[model samples]
Target: MQFGIFSVSDITRDPVSGVTPTEAERIDAIVRIARKADEVGMDVFAIGEHHNPPFFSSSPTTLLANIAAQTERLILTTATTLITTNDPVRIAEEYAMLQHLSQGRMDLMIGRGNTAPVYPWFGQDIRQGLPLALENYNLLHRLWREDVVDWEGQFRTPLQGFTSVPRPLDDVPPFVWHGSIRTPEIAEQAAFYGNGFFANHIFWPTSHSLRLIDFYRQRFEHYGHGTKKQAVVGLGGQAYIAKRSQDAYKEFRPYFDEAPVYGHGPSLEDFSTMTPLSVGSPQEVIDKTLTFHDSFGDYQRQLFLMDHAGLPLKTVLEQLDLLGEEVIPVLRKELDARRDPESAPAPTHRGLTEAKYGDRPVRRPRPNANRGDNVTGASPYQDSDAEATYPSLT
Candidate 1:
């Protein structure tokens, strides 16, 4: 199982301090957080993209590329890459470039952003968001796999023999996770392609997310991917922790009350009871998070929203330290023990590539292949004329 932190990059005032971080501070803080993730042995660090107010991550690829340059092993990813508005061509090119820069430690989630106004800002009608997501993703998939594309779509201009540059590292595209809060269509899309389905299961009850994941898993099997359990899955969560449950509640209460997303809505107690927001001791968080795997079955990734609510940078880092030292080690062991290889397997570049193209025969060197080529540095397989005089060894 992969574990990491995801930031929406909300620039809100710290309710207790009455200080809002400058945009520069927020951006710098994200850098620090990502480095901390690497230092503490986290597997991934994802940034959410938003174009509206109170959100700093309008350009996730730029930010992730910067993070990628600094970190060595962490898998840089996006919380949401807006498939509804952004052109698929741009996403394909930009992320493929990122894949080269990162050397394959990258993946992304496709989402129709939560805000409705963002559609118009991008010159798209909100009503056509679903169709736009479907069509755009279809094009984006082809852009990665095919060397040349000649196609037309409803939302974007047609392309004739268009080839995106900086082909994906390792000849494999970055894995995609379809992130949806409530949309089953998104889940279906992920299943149809045998991609990962991520339920941002923060706001809703566990039962709701279970149903969505179940639907995706079932359809994934129906599409001939594998059994339901073998379908790729990921889940989102929120947590605040302390040595004692009381300290956690006392410290995180003010932040929760003034949270930009869910503040002034539900009591902290109500929120914890009703949603997945667990503000308590580390063990409580572990207990609740384990229940998700139990209910939804083994998943590939688990991302936590820990840096939001305007917590101080120092506090957030401390939280990460505790998570690295205490939480993740245990979760890793438990999840690994429960995972059945035939049912729930980790998604990997080699696995996905083999699944997609393994059955196809390897093309042998043609008899006249590169016959006139003068390059002396060519591989023996490409030395077709030399092969006639001397049989080549495998």
Candidate 2:
């Protein structure tokens, strides 16, 4: 299984110090945190996207591209690409460029996002979130696979003979994972397209997550992607670990109490018991994470939330060290011990490209130059069936 960490980019004050980091400081620290994850042998590092204050990750491509330049092997991704608000056309162009720039080390997760006001801010209605998500992703899927797209949808303006530039690296689009916290239709959507489904289990009970994952797996098999057990799945978790369980709990209680998301609600101990949040030693974290397999089957990826709730840079980095050095080694062995031979591997760009074009040369579509240095040109469309895979204007 692939293991990594995701940061929501929340800029909250340290409850212990009452000192909040400046925007510049927080952004730089995130870069450091990502570098630390890479240094510690983690497989992926995903950054969240939010347009409002207290969360400063509006431009994920710019940030992830920068992170990509600094790291070599770590996969750079977004926690959510905001499918409802951001234009699908922009999403296609930006992430396709990211795919090439990262040289096959980039992938992304798409979601409708949690912030409701963000919809209106982007000139959309919050009530139309589900439809917007469905329509937008359908368009994005077509944009990546097809060269020129002529489409009309309810959420965005129509596109006639539009093509997202810099056709994906090796002519294989970056793999996408549909992220959903409580939406089964999103799970169905992922299964329909044979994409991975990620359940954010950090905030919900195990039973709730089990139902969602089971639904995805069932739908995946129904859609003829693979067997239920072979469907690509990913889960999210949160942890704050140290050498001892008591010590970890003592250190994290203050942050948990003051956390904006769930602070001042349930006791940390209670929350840990109820959700995937484990505030304990490395062994405890390993044990808790292992239980996911029992409930969700042989999942492909496991991502933890380690650097939130105003934790200092030093502490978060140390958590990564413990996770990479102490916890992951044991978890990997134990989880792989009784592996299913037919299980699918976690999605990656190199694997996807190879699956598409093994010994043969991968096609690269070079679009005609834009007449006005933009999408418009004498013919920006590559007019190549090899990449388009079907006729345009369908």
Candidate 3:
């Protein structure tokens, strides 16, 4: 299982210090956090997308691309890309650019975000959220695979012979994981495409993720991708750790009581027991995380929520140190012991490329000479990069 951290990019005030990080500080901190995750031998680093106050990650692709340049080996991805609001054409173009820039050290997770007013802010209706997500991803999937796209959808204007620039590196689009908290349609969509399903298992009961993952696995098999056990699955979790369990709670409690997401909803103890939030010693965090495999069976990725709820950058960095030095090493051993490599291997760019094209030359698309409107004429792909007739890769 791949292990790492995710950020919501929230700008919350630290309850203990009574000091909220400036937006600049929070942004810089996330960049530092991404590099630290790489330094610590973690596998993935993801940031969320939000367009409202208290959340600052409106442009996840841009931020992830920046993170991509600063680190190697870490799989840079979005905690949840807003599939409902962003133009699918832009997503296809921008992420493909990132894939090339990162040399395939990237993938993305898609979800209909929780924020409601964001729908109309982007000229979409909240009522049509599910349909928007479904249709948009369908188009995105096609955009990555097909060179010439002529599309007309309910939410977006028509496209005529459009090509999303910078065709995916190796002509293999980044692997997608559909994320959902409550909606099963998203799970169904992921399975239909033979993609991965991710449960944002933070701030919720494990049973919630269990049902969603189980349904996805069954549907994935029904669609003939693989057996139920072979379905691709990713899970989200949150934790705060220290040398002692008591210290962990004392440090996290103040932020827990006043932060926006789950504040005042349930007592911390009750919430921890009911959900995947683990505030404890390193051992406790490891022990709690292990139970997830027993509950959901073998899965592919595991991401932790480490930097949120008013935690200071220094403190969050310390948590990563504990996670890297003390927690993940043990988890890796335990999870590897239980999982067979062939049945549940890690997802990597090399692995996916080989799966798609084994011991064969990969295609490198060269765009045709410029054509106005892309409506009447354009050659979208060429085999060689040295040709003067081909436009530069976007």
Model 1 TM: 0.89
Q: Which portions of model 3 show Cα errors greater than 4 Å? A: 371-378, 383-394
Q: What are the per-residue Cα lDDT tens digits for candidate 3 across 1-394? A: 8998999899999989999888898999999999999999999999999999788899888898899999978999998999999999999999999899999999999989767899999999989999999999999999998877889989899987677888899999899999997788999999999998999888788888889888999999999988888888898999989899999999899989997889988988998999999889999999999999889888889999998889998999999999998999999999989895555466777888999889898777666554664532345555433333434569
Question: How far is 48's C-alpha from truth in model 2 (Å)?
Answer: 0.9
Q: lDDT scores for all predictions?
A: 0.84, 0.89, 0.88
Which of the predicted structures, 1 or 2, would earn the higher lDDT when compared with the native? 2
Considering TM-score, which of the candidate structures 1 and 3 is the better prediction for this target?
3
In model 1, pairs of residues that clash are none
Ranking by lDDT: 2, 3, 1
Error of 1 at 178 (Å): 0.6
Q: Against the hidden true structure, what lDDT does model 2 obtain?
A: 0.89
